[model samples]
Target: MHDFSHCQIVLGSSSPQRKLLLESLFPEANVRIVPPDNPDELEFTGSKNLFAIMRQLSQIARTKSENVTSQLLDPTATYVLTADTVIFVPDDFDTYLVLGKPPEEDRDGVVRAWFLDHYLGKTHHAMTAICLRVPGGTVHEAFVKTAVSMEVASEEMVDWYLSTGEPAGKAGGYAIQGLGSIFVSSIQGSLSNVVGLPLRETRELFERVVQNGDS
Candidate 1:
């Protein structure tokens, strides 16, 4: 198993997929769970620059790490890990259509339908930013970008997917690791990123932290 014997790892996310992925990666380590008191709320009204998106995601992960760390009994012996994922689709106007979890306000199928109508049979990028707050207060971070091609779905298929109530809290109104997998044509990068974490990069980051005695 991957070595992280020196640190008490706390995963700061509520996504089941994220938890499962982390558990599979560090089966030997006892990873704890600490969901954020408040879910992240990002405003998507600006330009979809890659740098800007990465920065925002990194900041969110950093904040989550800090928040989770504050709750630990001994912050000096814990490592809090957090992550955020976003779906990026470029529009025809030389801009991007960034998608996160559908806002709580869009209870109707407006947002969900919009995503399915446009994103189905299209190419998009899924970016995930991960951060680890070491016991020494040093934060290690990384971002992974994956190119995903979605399959074209018929109206009935789209309706069925939406009816499952799985898209409400997912980026791009879909989850690649669940029933949503059937809607994906191909993925060119880290599948774990689309699932909400980048396994390879996350493991490498943890190894570096352990090697440097940051944990």
Candidate 2:
């Protein structure tokens, strides 16, 4: 494990989940929370193709890192981290539907329908693209995909969950770490990935950066 006690970590996101995850990763490090500028401005314009969507997710994370790094006075001396996550819901057709956060306006209707129709009793992949901009300007990127299965939920159950207000800003209209966990039946990969950041992969990426910096 790399000791982050002496390092400076700049988290380029407004997500409280990611902030808490990063803090857990580097308990003693100086972690600065700098949200990206115009975060909603960068939209995903990729195709429904899975590979292309994954690439676009990584690009979005990279863009977030760039947005934050541009605000730093000494980018060469600090490590910057940013991440983007989406739920890949398989449709009846051959292609998959990419589900980001639900629209703020229709949390009651859209989110309820999503849980009842697309999410409940269905397995979706939670994909998170992580970008780490190490000191000296080199950027390391990776994506983690986890299969998540949701138990069948009734309309009343979905409505009750919606009343909790946990689905508003969550991808796929649910948060795995919150009350939403009741809906998750199984997960094939890292649970942390579904939460927002994959710890093992993130640690590996940071170690790789440190090794390269030493070389």
Q: Give TM-scores for every candidate, taking all chains together and pairing residue i with residue i.
A: 0.90, 0.94
User: lDDT of candidate 1 vs native?
Assistant: 0.81
The per-residue C-alpha lDDT of model 1 at residue 185 equals 90
How many Å off is the CA of 104 in candidate 1?
4.3
Model 2: lDDT of residue 105? 86
lDDT of each: 0.81, 0.85
- Position 124, candidate 2: lDDT: 88
After superposition, candidate 2 runs with Cα above 4 Å error: 92-94
Q: Which residue pairs in model 2 clash with each other?
A: none
Candidate 1's displacement at residue 5, Å, is: 3.7
- Which residue window of length 10 is worst by lDDT in model 2? 39-48
Off by over 4 Å in 1: 104-108
Cα displacement (angstroms), candidate 2, residue 90, comes to 0.7
Candidate 1 lDDT tens digits, 46-79: 7467777878888788888877887788878777
Error of 2 at 189 (Å): 0.4
